[model samples]
Target: MVAVTSSVPVTDPTLLDALRSDLRSADYTLDGVRSLLGPVAADALDREEALPARVVTASALASGADGRATLLRLFQLGEDVTRAALDAVLPTLRTAGAERLGLVATQGADDGDAVRAVVDLSPYAAVDAAGEVDWWIASDLGEVARRGALPENFVLGVGGASRTLAQITVREPRGSVLDVGTGCGIQALHASRHAGAVVATDIDARALAYARFNAALAGVRLDLREGSMLEPVLGETFDLVVSNPPFVITPRGEAGVGEFTYRDGGAVGDDVVRSLVTSVGSVLAPGGVAQLLGNWEHRRGEDWAERVGGWLTESGLDGWVVQREVQDPAQYAELWLRDGGITPDRDRARFEGAYAAWLADLDRRGVEGIGFGLVTLRRPALAGAAVSPWRRVEEITGTVAQPLGATIARVLDAVDLVRDLTSEALLGRRWQVAGDVTDERYFTPGEASPRVMLLRAGGGFARTVRTETGLAAFVGACDGELTGVQIVAALGTLLEVDAAALAAELEPQLRGLITDGLLLPAP
Candidate 1:
């Protein structure tokens, strides 16, 4: 384990209160910063380019700008400001309070009495399924500010992965929720809005310290603990479990490979994610759901679905795995290398060495490509049920709706409903096409009838399904006015086929449409 220092922010109530007041009074918020930096600079900052933002902030400071610019320069852009300027901006929690909180440090009389931020503090705002939130997050300064590789125990603030997990998480109200590997408490903070109680656990003590401070700053309560995955919550169950675990596959025993606490689990070849998928069910309450983001390897002569499905098979829970992206081994290596700040332009030899190590390690294991995606698992509500555990593993590499929590909840319900029903019972229910669904028909040049048909959804996963004439007619006739049996019988008569055979042929497709949100059960 890596040794963590005490340089993280402290949770002092009085100082925090004062800091909050000053921030609010100065309008140090997302909109405020955006207005100050304008669209170009703000967009540049989003791309991790700091020069435009630095130019804007430096100009603002030279012309005696407001507190927002000062804070942006000092805390966000890693620029130093005089103690007098900082005190003026943070009148309530002055330089002394900031120093006490470990947010900044003074350069003494030799460096012109300047102060620099030791940590990164910035505004965060989001309007998720749970509603809108505007808060400040504090974490380790990133490579953009440090101009070098991140420390092994670096605690990350809101990044692309954090936002991705937050957007995909199912956010229905629950009694208890657990956020595993809660780096800087971003997901836990979002969970607090819908859950009655939240317990966030991490193996890194430095991460816990940052999470604690963030919870205090946001005025949210989280039962924070220090332990590896599932250890802190042993023997306890939660209504929901969410994790953005350290699933990155870094080469072990490689000379230049970095062991980052935030990304690497110190395990070999996607085991961190596999272990979580197979074991998270032990902590889920009956009918509870666990949503996670992970990466799985696609090795030679092995199908990715079968490999990931094997994990689900061992979990004893209904599961859905969506592979959103795939990268070849070489592409995967370069991505993580640049992510760790070892760019070819900066350190050619080190970058080449690390890249070689990554390829060698992956090749040794017969790995060809890597699959990244979302995983959702559910414990059956009725124990010892006769129905087989349901599993859906697929690849969807395209645009989809944001805040997919509601769609996910609905899909789970649909799956459960269809799983328990017999073929005849399912046929007895009336169904209708979702409003977002539409069909396209293609005909041979001058043919009187259409030859090919397709069904596309505008929402949810934006799935498109190809159909034959019989299935297309079935979907077109679905208006919640006729049962499945009635529609199939009518189509059978018109197509000169047996109703029983047509029903059997279309039953699986209907169930698939329902689970994918293309069709819905009538009220």
Candidate 2:
């Protein structure tokens, strides 16, 4: 195992307060950083390239840019800066105070000594159900800054997956919430907004420390625990649980050569995700929900749904899984290898060995491709109730709604509302077409009426559904002015078809439309 030096700062209350003040005074927010770096440099920095940022910052400094530029160059780029520059940028924390917080280290004894950021601190902003929020997030430096493979226990900052999880998580108010593997506490911070209490756990001590520090910086309280998977929350039921766990499938060899605690769960071949799916429900309160992001192995002749659905079956919870993308073994290995900062062109031999080993492991297991996506699990309100569990596993590659939390909440509630309602009962209630739903028709040019009809949602998975003429007419008639049966009977009368036949065909479609937000239950 390669040893890594720890550079994360201690979370001292006094120092944190001073740092926060200094950060705010320097306008070190996301908008502030973007304004300082300009669009090109910011976009380049976002792609893990530092040259554009370096050039921009150098030009800004030469042109007499303010404190924010200096702070961004030092902390964000992991570059060394003069002590006087840092002192100017952080007058409240000063040089001595920053050292005490373990945020920076001075190289020489003189005032001209170079100071370097001990951790990567960046400005993050997101708009959720509760409105806009801007925060300063701190984590271990990335491979771009370190210029090497990540350490085994490195805690990652907010990335695409993290943001995806946050955006999809239902933000309803709850009594208690759990965030498993809460590296840097991003999920936990979001949870704290609506949840009465939040618990965040991680197997790595370093990760827990980072979480603690981040929670403090964000002014959110989190119950920090040190354990793996469900160990920390044993026997503790929660209203909601969310995780962006270590679900990455890494080939384990002698002494766990390439295992990372943040991504690898110390398990082989997607078992970690399977285990979490099966076991996480044990801590869910009745009518509770758990959301997670994971990857599952797709083997020859094996359907991805069956592999993931089986885990949900064992848990006895209603499961909804969406496979957003799939990658073959080579693509998967290359993506992760580059994520770990290993370049095939530069380190050909090492990359080849690791790549060959990963593919060989997949070959041994008969795996063809890997499917990555989201999972949402719900515990039934009543264990022995007549309501049958709903299991939906499918693929969705199109763009989904932002703040999908609202869509998820609507779907879950709609399922409960109509779960026990028979076709006769379903038709008795009035329905309305969602404002975001639109109807489109396609036909060969010059044809009179449309040959195919499509019902599309502008948000929430942006799903598009093909409908026959009868179903399309029924949906168009839903204006919250009449009952579903009234629309179906009226459509049947107009189309010269049996009313019951039309209702039977349209009832199932109604359920799907409602769940996908194309059809809304009347007020």
Q: Give the winner by lDDT.
A: 1
Give the alpha carbon lDDT tens digit for every residue of 13-83 in model 1: 89999998888888899999999999999999988899999999888888985899989988888788888
All models: lDDT? 0.90, 0.87
The 10 consecutive residues of candidate 2 with the worst lDDT sum are: 1-10
* Candidate 2 accuracy as lDDT: 0.87
What candidate 1 gets wrong by more than 4 Å, as runs, is 1-6, 109-112
Counting clashing residue pairs in each candidate, in order, gives: 0, 0
Q: Write out the backbone clash pairs for model 1.
A: none
Tens-digit lDDT track for model 2 on 1-523? 1122466778888888999999999999999888988999999988998899889888889998478788887777877888888888899889788888777777865667888877888889998878898888888888876777777778899999999999999998999999999998899999999999999999988888888888898888899999998898898999999999999888887332367778989788999899999998889999999999999999988887887889889878999999999999999998988887777665777788888888888888899999999999999888778777898999998877787898898889888877878888899999999998889999989999998899988988899999999888988988898998888879888999999888888888889888777888888
Q: Which candidate is the best by TM-score?
A: 2
For candidate 1, the per-residue lDDT at 224 reads 97
